[model samples]
Target: MSIRAIIADDESLMRSGLRLLLGAADDIEIIAEAAHGAEAIDLARELGPDLILMDIRMPVMNGLEATRTLMAQASHPEVLILTAFGTDEFVYQALRSGAAGYILKDTPPDELIHAVRAAANGTRTLSPSAVESLLGRGTTSATGLAGGGDGGAGPLGAGNPHTPDPLEPLTAREREIAEAVAQGMTNAQVARSLFVSTATVKTHLARIFYKLDVSTRVQLALLVNERR
Candidate 1:
């Protein structure tokens, strides 16, 4: 099945570049292009593409606001945020606002295509460079490793011998389910892994979502990964 897509960016050149890159792929179809966020929003509402590649900074409206508006609808397509700089911190805002994926503007052509396909399929995607960029911001909240809390040096092990944080505390079973989720296992897959019924896994996930204060699996992954 071909994945219909809308490419949105402020620069015509970037849109053209995407057209050339993704248009060549066999499974993707570029249904529309928008030069600004407002136009992107209108086109998205009209075309109802499977995915949108959105640039964060644009005239008339920014990608972040546009994504929020687009995703407010009942059948919103996934939005994959794009940024000019790999180190840009706007990705966090996009993810928090319900964006499905994120990639830097300068990402390799092949990876961009893959990211788009992943977003279209309801899978979460993030450039590791983007994650490193956010970590480089020097926010104390990034590692939570500074001082009297646990004396842990960082997420990676150190000689400090400190206990890791539980971003969302879970019971043994909940932790097992969460690990399966982190591994990209669907509910059925999780059930098979745990030798439990799919209904049971769904029940656990509902409770986990509430306990973690996250609305979606993407948010759950982000919050849980941050803890580790």
Candidate 2:
């Protein structure tokens, strides 16, 4: 079946260009397009697309907020964040926004198509530029994930209380949702970003909270940031 998708970007020309490119692919289908985050959320809820190509910057609401709200729902879709900024903060924030992947706005057409397919098939794809940022550009940086300070480690294999637990237990989607909530996305925003309903993001949050033994969004955010 063709992968149904929505393009959520504030730029009309960009959206139109993407639509044209994806339209030629037999395995993909453009179900909708939105010029802003709010419209993207509304249209996704209405169309029920399988994937969303979300732009990080937009009017009315940003992609991060939208992704957060979308992921809070009960039946959210996969989100692939696209942004012009490849800064560490932006890339990290996007990953934490429940996006299945992150890609630069200037990504090659073929790679973007591959990312859509990957997201639809339950695989996460990070833009090469974003990955480079995550790994740090040069040596002499902190080696541990999310850094080792601030009690950032979870109870991982080392039996150390500070070590982060193995992330293998959680589904990719759940992990993504947890990360997004950690980045401070609202349920509505997650729902829109993931192309799912608000109730779905809430369900995911409940499960994540239980697993993390946290009671509120604030606690969850702290935990994820500490152990991310």
Candidate 3:
């Protein structure tokens, strides 16, 4: 079955251009389009697309609010932000709002298509570098640990604020998987890159998530990018 998608952008030309570009992907089908955030919400409930290409700025309601609202649903589609703003604040806000991924509007066509495919499988669209470029090197939690509420200290076992953060507890294999995911590779992509099965990739991701204390791939990307 094809991955259903809804394009939500205020500009008609932009929507048309995206429709043309996404048309090339065999597994993606454009089931609906919206000019604003509220309309996107309506369509999401009505069509239940697999993905939503969301814009930050829109009339009626903004994409951030809409994303939060839609995510509150029992069966929500993955939301991917497609916007010109790549600021760290915007990226953080979008991720916190439950967006699956954040990609700049200037991304190459090939990458954009790949991101859509990846997002269809619940993969994050932002590269680690892209996440870093947009936001500060900080953890999502108040404790500065990638995992929220966990006061993580480095291998040195020193809790002093001045002590360097302990190395993340990832095995060599898990590290490899995190690196690939930080680069915005999907589980299938990571599996192919590592010559492993998708099931194996998922297993590693679970371990990585527990080790890093991040629930989402975007936060994992941010954590890994900070180390680079």
Highest TM-score among the candidates is held by which one? Answer: 1
RMSD of each: 7.1, 10.7, 7.9
Model 1 agreement with the true structure over 1-228: per-residue lDDT tens digits: 999999999899889989999999999999999988899989988998999999988999999999888867767889988887564467667776778877887788888888898788766677776656555653213222111111112332122226465543688899887656654567887898799999999999988876766655666654554555
Model 3 Cα shift for residue 163 (angstroms): 17
Off by over 4 Å in 1: 137-189, 198-215, 225-228
Error of 2 at 52 (Å): 0.7
How many clashes in candidate 1? Answer: 0
Error of 3 at 194 (Å): 18
Better TM-score candidate (1, 3)? 1
Say which candidate scores most in lDDT. 3
Over 35-148, each residue of candidate 3 has an lDDT whose tens digit, in order, gives: 999999999999889999999999999999999898777679999899988776787778767777778888889988988887777755574444464535343322222211
Window of ten residues with lowest summed lDDT in model 1: 143-152
Give the residue spans of candidate 2 off by over 4 A: 137-210, 213-228
| Residue 72 error, candidate 3, Å | 1.1
